[model samples]
Target: MAGVRAGFSTDLGGRLNVEPEVRAVVDATATVFTDLGATVDDACIDLLDAAEVFFTQRAYDFAAWYGPSLHARPESFRDFVAWNIEVGLGLTVDDLLSKDAARVRLAVAVDDFFTDHDALVTATSQVLPFDASWDYPRSINGVPQEDYLDWMRAATLISSTGCPAVSVPAGFARPAGVPDAPELPVGIQIIGAPGRDVEVLRVAHAVEAATGHGRRHPDL
Candidate 1:
């Protein structure tokens, strides 16, 4: 992601509406994990407390390594420095010790979660518009009209866990408010334990076979 940001930074940084969508997607996918952790096959779910920390730290490290060449939003970049550097560096000796303890617990939780469940299934994206025309030819500092970040929620969440996940076409549905909008594709995300990429892919194949959604094509 940082690499992609760097590539498009000069041309698209200020022009692209990227943060809101990404945040929305992450929040929506977090709910799926939280709910699944609570219920579903009596499985024990692992919730990482520092998931955002992992994400932001990676972003911050990328920024530090690459310098200001990659910028998402000015405000966002400031917050990254403030949270991961300024505030993080201010942590007391005791606080640092506690953080280490928390990470140990987090590791155990993650291990337990994978042990309990073979795979996880959820929406690929919470929201995406069929009308591509609305998103193209963006202007500088243009705010996204409506949030579509939920579209990558599953991917981001799974990424934090260092687990392998795949998204398969589930089916299609018409946009909720668009008049005469065509049906848009929906995806099902399948996630597996770390190093279980094969299992994830096999389940995704089974899902694709069962749904037969791949056979369909857009009206275009």
Candidate 2:
């Protein structure tokens, strides 16, 4: 997200022609945030806000961060479609997580970094009160905060710079011995950075906000 731009994946994807320009604004906003000392998630929210602010002023439904991704459209863009909501501005940690998986709560960040054999993430999230998971390319050696940042930065550099990140609740994987109902679900994510997190959440929120999803999750 640090160096990502909205149009980075244009060759691979495009907005519904109607909103292409707005998508570009989001890309520019990501660049602006990088220049402004904001992290990916921080910059993303603002960029999203700017888009909603624009349309909201127009009275076009500020649901940019809150819209639906599922809709009927011209068939030309049909093949590219999937769960696309995430349209307007608003709040909700769940929605944010639905939009970006990189937004971690940092429960075991410090402890994970200092443990033996580079097991930082494993050590930390494993012991935390809630259920958690990690995606270290190497073995999970939960690193300290500094080390965790180092890990993220290094990973960003090594991987494709434009990887979109989202961490939506994947539902809980309860420990067998525990007596409590699942505390809260962990997240599932699809990494991308065209700043389309809004589209992602719009549809996701509509569904998650619906009656029974965790019971029957579908691919987005």
Candidate 3:
């Protein structure tokens, strides 16, 4: 990791409501990079339109992959899956075109960011791991999440950038005011420019070695 220039962003410029614990993990990961002889700074690519791009493209994909099955046996799929297929089926040509344009802008912005930095770091998730019975966290930091995808904006927004990103265990977060509360795992996302998968992995590897968080397993 020596001499590698890395940039870290905890909240995607405050576009996402990241939990304080999650943000702290990413911030700590930035320190790990600096200690590894890499230059770390606060930086984030413009992802304001990333959610739109990702959801639009995903809806299109869902329609292509499941529209036939949905039409044949709607009862076989869950409500959210059926909803996604319906959304895809209802997309207008203009909707796709506009999102495509936005996607292009995001790609360009990510490429530009990488020209100045080797890797981008972010919180892997906006909130801690939730109960298995829940579909997804209904809220993050007291902010209501509108749908299944809302809780996952952190990763989905990055996906729209078409960059290679890897998530590595950063540390653990224990709930506040609960002395005996179990420690929840937190992750740091390491992202690189297009075709820079190896660099991202190298950064992830360095982080794993530095923190040793990956070696710790939860008590089941």
Candidate 4:
């Protein structure tokens, strides 16, 4: 990882929330079996812990194979990523009526996201790759991602203003005793604290390096 620093961002992926109720019991007694909610929580946690799987598309594709660490750091450090950004919600009188009201407002934002994505999709139709491959094109100038990001924002509506949203590499591991190998590039992400993208990137870099999977490639 020395002298190899890569900046990556994704719009398809976001930190997952396990429903407030499921989170309430993750720390329950060991004697208790994992209930439906607990199982759901575990799955959500696992999914978030596996963010690297989705960080696949980038603005730039490396010339040679990037080490596993270069891909993502698979580790579960926290619940979110730190974002040095601005996030907010503008509420109208309708949304103030009930929780479902928030959904209506959210839909508006989501529609906006779709619109943005569609615009980019249209513009990039000739250039965008429809499948995954090492020779596929890459772009990180922040142009192609507008739409993916729009959808992500609409799906994961932020409660607090731009705060910390982080992603940790979740190394691939299977059920205990299954001897499942680790997926070098797996990452779990968390998002928090806006205006601190540097911090988020720094921490993510360190975690990814420690996961020791960034330098390997599929030989495409």
Quality of model 3 by C-alpha lDDT: 0.87
Model 2 per-residue lDDT tens digits across residues 1-220:
2222222221112111212222232233333323533233321111222222222222223235223333333333322122122223344556454433322212132123222211000000212132235422221233343322222321222122233344333333433355564433333232333344564454334323442335653432
How well is each residue in 97-166 modelled by candidate 4, as lDDT tens digits?
Answer: 4434434454454344333221100010112122354322233323343333322331233322223455
Off by over 4 Å in 3: 218-220
Top candidate (TM-score): 3
Question: TM-score ranking from best to worst?
Answer: 3, 1, 4, 2
TM-score of 4: 0.28
Instruction: Return model 3's CA RMSD, one decimal.
Output: 1.5
Query: What C-alpha lDDT values do all the predictions have?
Result: 0.48, 0.29, 0.87, 0.28
Query: Where does the lowest 10-residue lDDT sum fall in candidate 2?
Result: 117-126
Local accuracy of candidate 1 as per-residue lDDT tens digits, 71-116 = 4344645443444444343445566565556556656765776665
**True lDDT of residue 186, candidate 4:** 30
Q: Highest lDDT: give the candidate number.
A: 3
The pairs that clash in candidate 3 are none
Clash pairs detected, candidate 1: 21-149, 25-150
Give the winner by TM-score: 1 or 2: 1
